[model samples]
Target: MMKILLIVFNWVGKGTYWRALKFAEHLCRRGREVTLLATSQHNRIGIEERIINQVRLVETPDLFTGSLRSGWDMWNVCNRIAWLRNHDFDIVHVFEARPVALFPALYMQRIKHISLVMDWADWFGKGGSVEERPNPIIRNILRPVETFFEEHFRTWADGTTVICTTLQQKATELGVPPNTIVMLPNGCDTERFEVIPHQIARRRLHFPHDMLIIGYMGSIFQHDAELMACAFDIICQQIADVRLLVIGYCPIDIRQLVKKPQYVIQTGFIEDEYLNNHLASCDVCWLPFKNTNANKGRWPLKLNDYMAVGRPTIATAVGDVVSLFETEPIGLLAEDNPMSFAEKSMQLLHDSTLRLEMGTHARHVAETRFSWADLTRRLEDLYQYILKTGTK
Candidate 1:
């Protein structure tokens, strides 16, 4: 049996947590022994550990009690490394690059002859809260150290997987061989996100029967939520009974812009348990992103959920959206502006037949291209190849 260890940097129930959990679960279903290593609060650590579908999760506890940011992060890294020393794994797959924790794992890999694979999902040192506002002196001091470890690991790893072509390009630019990089986009559970009766879902959510609902998922900061609100407001003027449904946390600034609070409904932070049902209630999904370098590298996870539920998406022509949806008629691709977005959304809203056709195309794409089964098969291939070659 192949034993694989997946290391996630944080223990949040969203983003990396969901990705790690889904991958671990699917990999386990393929008859591989998978253990997910994550970090949580001292009281919560190890308490949630359980074998679910043959995947074991072991969360290390933070050493400190309070939320002293730097101290908590440093201690968490040390704790994870200490826990890793006692375990045995044939393969170690790390989701993000953090030198403090990863360096210790690398040392173990060298001594233990364990294979290492690194995954790149987004841009480093850009747009996160810590990176957004940092002490310049510290940032400058750590820049070289961060770069040294990142490049060293990328060059040393047996194999690498990236979320998009843009990141693959970045890896090549940084001296990683093109052959070593596999482009793996985000995917969804097609079985879980299947089409539900529109009225049935709406009735459950208490949505109006005759309303045209446009929805957006994920955290508010990921995309231009204010622009989405602006686009929805414009759509409302052209079509009566148009409603905006936000399934995740909405920022206070974005919340302040909505003119008709009654027409716009925000279900802040929908848990994974109720995500599918809430997503199925939408008539259309929006992916409104401001054109930025970081945004270009992102292949939004919500795209999969939208496609999985057979809903048409009106998205900006950025990142993988152009390659994924522009050529095919699965979704409408518009320029990154409010007017263009509103126009394309209104197009979908005006024609029920077009929306239905697009939705069907979206689901077909999901089944063929973005299903978790397909993704796991591809990863299995990569794993076999890496084990055979010893390095790629």
Candidate 2:
């Protein structure tokens, strides 16, 4: 069995954690030995221990403090390089676009390395411009330094993988060979989200039997909360049985909007099992992302989770979301407007046939196409290719 070493900034509660976990699990199941090397904390101990036989935790000092000085970041880079030089592995997999972590791994190229660019961070400065990114104070101070480090790392890696086509194009523009870069879209773990009886789930959550629950589960930003509140108000006016179930953190100011009796149910920061319970109960799941630079390149992880249980979703047409759901006959896509969002959501709530059909299709897609097993196969193939070619 071939040995693999996966490296990332830190592994906690995020998209990266899920991606790494899925990949490691798939590799281990195939009789390959996998070792995950992360900066600190191992919060998903249960998942990792189940899959990977070895996990190495490296200690690195916090670089982002008050001021944007270069010293701290530079110190962290040196420390990471020291750690990498001491470790021996057959293949190294690095995630993140930051040069601080990339540079050290690139310098220690005794073993083959694969760099997976999850998102293009440099695009944040340009206001989505391709020719030149905006010269913000932070970018102006950091871009040149990061570029120098990235250039070396890009050239050093044995192979590279990008999450989306747009990201692959960006990497090509940045001088990475088109052949070296591979496309591996984010995916969901379908087994974890098996469908439960809606009525049973509602009973478990203590939600009313007859009400239509429009649920959302994630960090509710202020703008998102306001938009959802506005949409809910419109839906309530049109349909009396409609109720909102928000299962994540919402700011104090926004929480006030849901205070109207029998209108909204707020379960802030629920555990995963409870969140899944809420997901099973909901009539529909929401992916209300604002059309901003922050969201354009985003591939919301929740969409897969929502679909895993055969739940139809309503989302704003932002980033690669349009493409992700365009083929999804199971969900509805709307413009990033409250009126449009409300109209689309109501369409799903009012028609049980449409909901059932879409939900069935969604579950089929989740099981066949978006399963973690399939996603990890793609990742494993890329790892083997990198090992064979000795380039990323």
- Report each candidate's C-alpha RMSD, comma-separated, in the order given: 3.2, 5.1
Segments of candidate 2 deviating more than 4 angstroms: 39-83, 99-104, 110-156, 220-223, 249-253, 256-262
Question: Which ten-residue region of model 1 has the weakest summed lDDT?
Answer: 125-134
User: 199, model 1: CA deviation in Å?
Assistant: 1.0
Against the true structure, whose lDDT is highest?
1
In terms of TM-score, which candidate is strongest? 1
Evaluated at residue 323, the lDDT of candidate 1 is 84
Per-candidate TM equals 0.89, 0.80
What tens digits encode model 2's per-residue C-alpha lDDT throughout 1-392?
A: 77676655543434365666566667777877776544433221111222233433343554454223212355566666666665666666766545544655556554424333332322322433221223467557655655454344464455676665556666787788777776666677776677876899999988889989988876544566667777778888899887888776554344476535468787776777776778889999898877765466445667778888889999988777788689778789988888999999999999888988888888898887777677778777767776676554
**What lDDT does each candidate get?**
0.75, 0.66
Misplaced by over 4 Å in model 1 are 41-48, 63-72, 99-101, 126-152, 251-253
Residue clash pairs of candidate 2: 126-134, 157-392, 158-391, 158-392, 159-391, 159-392, 160-392
